[model samples]
Target: MTTFTIGDVTITKITELEATGDTELMLPDATPQAVRQVTWLHPHYATEDGLLKTSIHAFAVVTPTRRIIVDTGLGNHKMGRPVPAWNGMTGTFLQDLTDAGFPPDGIDTVLCTHLHVDHAGWDTRLVHGQWVPTFPNARHVFARTEFEHAEAAPGHGTAELFADSVTPLVQAGLVDLVPANEQVTPEIQMVPTPGHTPGHVSILIESRGERALITGDFIHHPVQLARPSWTSAGDHDPGRAATTRRVVLEELARTRTLLIGTHFPGPTAGYVIPDGDDTYRLQSLA
Candidate 1:
């Protein structure tokens, strides 16, 4: 279990699963030769052969006032995943959460960065042939634009995701639709960082004087931090994703804020250090 704290709030990384994906697939513009040039990526983010290492994990943010879960990872017993491996996945995610000291009923809020298949899977669980909210007592919060955009959005990619993981929460009156920049709590706020999805946002956590940003797929891998232009395969809008990535990086590098990538591989939290005029490297906090 990896954990970090900013002032009074404590954030822990509870991993649901870890796996390696094709580097070229993760960054379409990245060639094997190109990736090797970025020496900083090896040993953690990528393999010697350029396979991109990644993890599906959730951040449990425990504030003095609220126990919030940011981005539930790909859940168990889910189906209709475009990728066969993610479909019908079974893991000890809840047990892992409990092991980390946050119980299901103890979670006060579920913050979804976006409704992508992997990010929002644990919002609900299947029981007795029915879908139900996993966190019986927590309020599942989603960006209003993101919640509405899923309805008219093309493709059935997120259709099963909505029916199984999201709609059930709404049916249970556990879903709250807020603006993209909604202030979740006194120390936690959502930053409108679109491009991965229309209403995609990152969690900006501040308390006392310390700050950290939970990047929800706005930037998937650390490689993008260096190139700042190599887009993810799952990006809804690669061009806009790249643009937003650069802007986000500037702020992260400028202030050296702690960055936690939702899908980043080993040691997910880090600081963006300026390596050159246009290059930034992830200096892991581990």
Candidate 2:
């Protein structure tokens, strides 16, 4: 379900989407309305507001020595979600991972860009109604600050989501709560790109002069390449998220860094390119 290799790193996109009904998730002003314009939505997706869709993707980063997973998508057995699509259900993300040749036990590290439902879903799995780490041997890495905040606001309806997907990993001794800016490896560095979450970090990979930035929910669609200020309603801090998006896009556009959006449609892997006069577009790799 995921794409692979911008340079040397191998990426696998895992999906748990039940449908592809809503097509307009990209907006025109997004690059310039996000999800409203750049998105290739069908006629049905058009509405008074904008496009909307729900296909969750999780990325696995396979290196020479380490098998790392970035952002575990929506998992099974989660409760209290608004949508019936993502609440208390079973899916095939793990099966798809194995089909992609990465079994659950093979993952050495679980890197959560942030602790949202879609981003942190597969950290654990259901075993006779118990939440267990999907990757039994892997260390679940999360931002200490994010975990704290989510923990503090337990009854605010977000508590159960984090409790099932995150807290159990910590209690089982598989969690590695690191500082916001901790560098997991030479090829991998966690840049503290807060706003989405207080400790949200984007994973950067540089090898043989080739660099790829796994943009974990920083900007959802290609539209953000142009209008970096259009924060999604889901962003924890819209203003800060917009600011981070602008800064990240500016640098990526300037440096021509390769990128992979965790939620981008079709070929999720691509690069942010200057379209014209300060505008930008996403060029996907085949």
Candidate 3:
């Protein structure tokens, strides 16, 4: 139940799905030989098979003028997820949103952190056997570069992510693709944190004097905070991802700003701290 407020805005975490996925391969730099070197950081994640959990977190950004949702996690009816649990299945996502006291119709804007499957899942829903924007009256925001990547349809890693989660939004005319550094509101702005994706951007919340960053996949897990080089196997550009990770970690450490990681353990909100010369750690906040 970790929530934060900035001026008139109130942000709450709305979870859609929670399950462990192939994380063992993510360690030792996703190498075949390093399989045995993997270990779980928490007993809750029983096995080392990546020992990671996927959470579809929706950040309900309640402002005086608008109710925005930053990152809509995997929506229902998504196809072609490597993991069976992520594919064509009905979950309580929309109901959960309403349970949290904010219905889909209440949302004025839906901001995607990036166009990854998990981040863009809830962007659309099944309607009369067709996919449609889950947020009917909302303007779905996306990065122009991100949409292009989907338009190109690269290959395995991100091909389906766009075809399923993003392209449909464009078809519906509800999407608003902006420049990488576009600012949606006075209290919110986008920071160029590409690497995970070509136009990946992290949302910055500057209200009053406090600051917070809604990190999409700039760094997936807390372990990345300890070893910023642990790039995800799904990264479109590993080298660039590493560089972005280092830079973002440094900035988060310097500013002592609160960060919200999409797949972070438990509450998924924390601050970065220096572990050694180049390593850092995630210190969960109150």
CA error at residue 20 for candidate 2, angstroms: 5.3
Per-residue lDDT for 221 in model 3? 72
The alpha-carbon RMSD values of the candidates against the true structure, listed in the order shown, are 1.2, 3.7, 3.1
Residue 34 of model 3: what lDDT? 39
| C-alpha positional error of residue 150 in candidate 2 after TM-score superposition, expressed in Å | 2.2
TM-score of 1: 0.97
Candidates' lDDT values, in order?
0.87, 0.73, 0.76
Where is model 3 poorest over a 10-residue stretch in terms of lDDT?
32-41
Residues 1-286 of candidate 2 have per-residue lDDT tens digits of 5566646677777776734334323232432144456443322222335544334688888877789999888888888764566787777778888888889888899898877777777888889979888898998888789778767755434577777887788788998888878788767778888777667788888777788888887777655675566667666787898888878877887787887777666666677787765567777775
Index of the highest-lDDT prediction: 1
**lDDT per residue as tens, model 3, 1-286:** 5577766567899887665655653444543233223343343322354445545578888877888999888778888876677788788878988888889998999888776677778887878987777888999888889878766865543577666666687788888889989988988898889888888899998887778898888887766776678888778788899999998889889997888877765667777888888787667764
Top of the candidates by TM-score: 1
**What is the overall TM-score of model 3 with all chains considered together?**
0.88
Query: Which candidate order results from sorting by TM-score in descending order?
Result: 1, 3, 2
Candidate 2 vs candidate 3: which has greater TM-score? 3
For model 2, the run of ten residues with the poorest summed lDDT: 23-32
